[model samples]
Target: MPSHPSPPARSAVVVPYAPDAPPPQLAPLAGPDRPGGPAVPERWNAVDRSAHAPHLVAVPGADATEWIAAALVTARPGTSYLKIVDALGDVPAAVGAVLETARRRGLAQVKWEGWTTTAEEATALGFTPLRTPPGAEGPDSGYIRRLYGAEPAAPPYYAQTTHFTCGAVTALVARAHAGALPGEALDRDAELTLWRAATNFPACEPVGLGVAVHRAWPSAPVTVFLDTEDPVLLDHLPEAEQEWRAALQRLSRADAERSGTPVDPRRLSLPEIRAALDRGGHVLLLVSLATLQGFDVPHWILCHGTVPGAVVVDDPWAHAPAGDTWVDAHLLPVPDASLDAMSVLSPARFRGAVHIAPASTGP
Candidate 1:
């Protein structure tokens, strides 16, 4: 993976809690600095009056472990809690507590560390140690690269194929927005293969989503128009595919001529895009990966005064609803569901293509 800047330091402290552990009867730490001033003694329980009372009741420092732990519990599982504490402080326990409270309150996906007394432990704690592939060590960083030839890129650790899946789709979507033509369909088959090979590796969902979005219009009824006035943005596109590049340039020139004006390479208005699609033209979603994180029709509604304009359907892809399902794309099938529902682009890697169907063509 590409090296990121050195992470901040972490404080040495352990918050006590177990996975599925019952909620602790919490007493608010006394703090005159708090919004309403320090908590009163009447609120303290018998445990609050003990030897740990003075320390527990004291106002937390900026690096307080309790504060750190509370924040982590809301995060996705497998997130680095040490990094949170390093940036904040010794509070894994406190974060776990907050997360536990949220879970009890009905948060289904509360984030917490998967701890185990035996390396083989699984069912009880809800964590199963993945077996090491031939010539590899533990679960965290092996398997994929060892079994397959793909290597992970910079921070967030995505493999080469994974990056290409997103990067290629992003470039294609940009071209389409600039008015590119329909070209050789993206390789969704290869993308799924790479994803399955890298199961348990982070950002797998983003990679898969990118491929699904890019390949959304294979022989589908969609037309893309591009602006010819602006220079092509194909410099960063993948080199393995030359046919795709030529098609984009053609579309851009055609779009520019049709509009009788220059297309803004930096931005495309929603009305203009929708009008083209309304007329049976296919729309290509061209947005950066950074902008894609947590993106949806709702976000576009806030920014563009329209639904995302593109609606991707869930096609063949892997999903593990139960622990019994093995991680393999071969077992998965293209879903008959809406693309948006199945191809969930994670906020972590926010960029890819989304095909807009015709006005008379969707739900």
Candidate 2:
């Protein structure tokens, strides 16, 4: 799937308003009186109407300004520094720490306040040190003044609209192809989709519970088979279909014993099994078929219609024994004698034949 557009830079602008400035209109999502009901509207709207609205607030803390600025220049202005500050309770100490860290990392610098740094100071600290033209003025210009100085309007918002930085995109896509995700969904889009699908609410709206998934495999490279009349993007799933079956059988048998209900392992589909593994709170079971051959569960495969390389992981299980009868063909039952020599594989590498290490066992 195509990646989501990078959030624009300049997430929030510091528009100067008098202390008595009228409440900026809330984003329709935020207004209690609005049709959306009590839900807080889009953050930008909230920023306009917030009690600290007119003040030049960085996302709540001092730390926000630097990261926020960095994000702005990089084209992710969706959530500005001050907006984050409000959400995080505007803690000065925490925010200040973020700023200090940014400076040390040469990511950003402060201007205007006593805490501000000069170009030379910024360069020494490893920053490129951007500044605005002298004497620039406007509602938006106020934001620039507070950062670099009274000068040219900060770079136009669109200037930041380049493709997601290489690091960000690579990481996001890698996660997506790895069966950890239904498919590789960009963070912003995936979260929004989950919020909407799970609650029938908009992405910006709040949900009581947060759910996440991590496919334990690498995204397989997608291959198109022109040999057939139809070009199917054949992507490999990490675990063989049989391994998935084994996992499900193991899980179903355990669940049956625990709930005193019979659940046929054969009936569970791939998606259902994946959903179960993705649930929060459970001690996840992972089996790593790392060196497994192609027919058994190739290490790579095509993903849901897109992405040349997508990793795939299927249902996971817990290592805890349900009962003697719960043993199923899906897993290699641990030998009682070797139980003391076992170690649970990392969740990301759950495809191997391994056993949980008993705490009583010594090296």
Candidate 3:
């Protein structure tokens, strides 16, 4: 994470306004003020800024010479989640004001990302450091403050070993949630073994991940729903790469048939996916990151909770700005409509998912 100039003296107090209040238009801090900040991160220019615009707030100083801090109480775009994106101001006070507004808005949790401050600062503001994956080390970590009394049971997070290993990581998270794999083993040797089994090398297929889980724990039942009609790989690849993808696709299908894993003819509906989660099952969902980020690649995420009109996912990939990159993708709320649109592979039009649970609980 790059360093930035220390914010102006913490003399001003944070103040919050109604959601419908007009947002303050603060000038972008000059390079000197930002210091070592990146030139421009993706989140700085999100596709839908209005959706992520935070609740309007102003931090005023008693004297005219003191700088007035500008802040927004906003949620991540594309989901009903809350976070505080602060500017040159007092972080602690900003967090305090955000929590008050969150409580008033009936939000259960609040997150702070790329916190340049110390852990003591966060704790003082009632935020707890989030758990990071094993063997992972970086300054771009985040903290979560749960406003509700009891916290939901979220699946443990596992960072993918490679760019194409998201499917394997997603499967490992589901296994950990089901107690098939010990919690500690998720970040160590066991993770490598699972990745090897789940991956189809260059590309991980839905059937491959299901077969891998079944092989690791026979007692854990696995159900796969694949769009066999259009098993699309990267369409932009050259002829040679396309042929290689075709070979991997064929291999995946043959392996699924050999393992006797039942493959549904169509994609799983949002309602059916919700029901599976209600029954304590975790789903390894295939989606296009291009829909969320600009990356045009097939990505895998673990679906563990379903709210009214949204799905809570644990994405293995973190595409946030610097000092927040690769943080825990814990219980990210994605609208059901956006998820449905992202489920199908672009150009290829293929859809697939794998559901895993304890064998004792029938599907």
lDDT of 3 by residue, 94-210 (tens): 455556656565665677654354566666666677765555533356666765433357677777666777887888788888777778777646656776776655667787778
Model 2 residue 230 distance off true place after TM-score fit, in angstroms: 50
- As for lDDT, the candidate ahead, 1 or 3, is 3
lDDT tens digits, residue span 1-363, model 2: 322111222224333333244224222213466332342223223333222222332232244433222110110111111211121122232234334433343331222111123444333322233323122121111110111112211111111011112112222232333323443244445434333332211111001111111111212221111111211111223345435434433443344244333222122223332333232111112112221211122111111110011112111111112110001111111221122112122222221111111113310
Residue by residue across 1-363, what tens digits does model 1's lDDT show? Answer: 433111122332324322233123222332454322322222222122121111121113464533332221111111111101101122333433333343343322221222212332222223223332122111221111011111212011111233334333333333333233333322445445433432212222222222333343333333322223322333333664435544544553454345332233223344554444344443334332121222232111001111222321111111122110111111111111222332222332232223344335631
Position 57, candidate 2: lDDT: 29
The runs of at least 3 residues in candidate 1 whose Cα sits more than 4 Å from the true structure, single-residue gaps closed, are 1-162, 167-189, 192-219, 223-229, 234-248, 251-285, 289-354, 358-363
RMSD of each: 18.3, 22.2, 7.5
Off by over 4 Å in 3: 1-57, 61-76, 85-93, 99-108, 114-128, 137-141, 146-151, 320-323, 326-328
Error of 2 at 256 (Å): 16
Model 1 scores worst on lDDT over the 10 consecutive residues at: 79-88
Residue pairs with backbone atoms closer than 3 Å in model 3 (clashes)? 54-73, 54-74, 55-73
Whichever of 1 and 3 has more TM-score, that candidate is: 3
Model 2: CA > 4 A from native: 1-50, 53-193, 196-363
Q: Model 2 shows how many backbone clashes? A: 50
